[model samples]
Target: MRIRKDYMGFAFLLFLAAANHWLLIPGQVLAEGSETFYPYLLNTALVILLPCYAWEIWRSRGRNDAPLFWEPGLADLGRILCLLGGIWLWADAMKHLGFILPTAFFLALCGWLYGEKSVRKLALLALVSPFVLYALFTMLGAALPQGGIEIWLSPLLVR
Candidate 1:
């Protein structure tokens, strides 16, 4: 039987998952109780789900009626690359400019790039989402990289 072209992407992701499970996560020394829980849970889920996904894909391989992969046009490829670059830039900018501003700008830019025509909705989403995420992260006890806005606003939030 011929291997499906879609399997290539799945293989790559499976390899990454394996590497993450074996090489990376094992090296991190966790704290006492709950800190180790998520990694173990993720590993278990990956172990179970990946094989199920592979099985489903294998079972579906006989059906030639539907296309397995969508061939993206050049414009789609360019937009995907731009989105990736934007994510990298946003991550870097968050270190220096803080989470809110960079996240807001990235959200707006992504919305515009992906063909959201309503300027007011885009503006509102761009403005509101970052703060909401920041608050969520803060409440969850995840320490985020801080800059001017975070520095100022953190005092007011008071844990």
Candidate 2:
């Protein structure tokens, strides 16, 4: 069977997922109950899903009769650059602004850049989602990186 580029990429990911499930995830669990459960559950799901992905990729091999694709156009390149720039900005801002503010801004900026013009919905998502994620991760005992904003808010957050 001839191995196409798409097949090679899918196989690489499948191998990676399986390896992480078997090797990395088992050592990373620090707690015996909830902390252990999520990682194992997710890794098991990925391990199961990856085999199905591999099978589908194998089954569909060489089905695309299209010739080798041309290089992406300048517009496509510009959008890719814009996405990278946005991500870089988000990371830089997060160092000082913390996860919540930068993530909200990043989400709103991404929505706008991708042509989603619903201001109300974007605003709601921008305002609410980050706080929810922060709370969820805190509840799950994940140590979020603290920035200036988080440092300031830590006193209020302490129970």
Candidate 3:
């Protein structure tokens, strides 16, 4: 009766997702109307699927051969910290800078950090990805975050 180390983090995430689905989502009003329909469906799927995933992980826990992958070195810790900081900053910025600019900047930074050295490719991704995502969600009738910058630049960017 031994538990594999790598399985714990995934198990914890599954538990959290399921708990959030069952405990928190029910409290939130998700009627058969408005934009909440998608969230409701997603939550339903997660609530149904997460337990099965957890059970599978538990049943098929394998030996940790790549033991070093779990343990973070100094460089890995620094990169993780940078990513966390970037996420925090992005969340903060989204209130003032809006969704597109901050998201694009964050994605570009992430791409650069993850070894995307081609400036043209990174620039293309940074410029196009946000607009495409915004359009996709907007087409689905989802209201995206519109902040000061986006409002000011709407004439140039938004239709």
Q: Write the per-residue lDDT of candidate 1 for residues 1-159, one digit (tens) a residue.
A: 344556765786788678767774565323212244455566678777778878877787769752356456789779989999998999799879988999999999899888999999999999999999888656655456688999898876764
Candidate 2 has its poorest 10 consecutive residues by lDDT at 25-34
Cα lDDT of all candidates, in order? 0.76, 0.70, 0.69
Models sorted by TM-score, best on top:
1, 3, 2
Which of the two candidates, 1 or 3, achieves a greater TM-score against the reference? Answer: 1
Report the Cα lDDT for candidate 2. 0.70
TM-score quality measure for candidate 2 = 0.56
Query: What value of lDDT does candidate 3 attain over all alpha carbons?
Result: 0.69
- What TM-score does candidate 1 get on C-alpha atoms? 0.61
* lDDT of candidate 2 over 1-159, digit per residue (tens): 343555556667777777666765554344223355556675678777876877776677567762243355677568778988988998788767778889889889878776889999899989888878777666656545567766775556555
Total backbone clashes of candidate 1, pairs 3 or more residues apart or in separate chains: 0
Flag regions of model 1 displaced more than 4 Å: 1-69
Error of 1 at 25 (Å): 8.8
The prediction achieving the highest lDDT against the true structure is: 1
Candidate 1, residue 41: CA error in Å? 8.6
- Show how many residue pairs clash in every candidate, following the order shown: 0, 0, 0
Ordered by lDDT, highest first, the candidates read 1, 2, 3
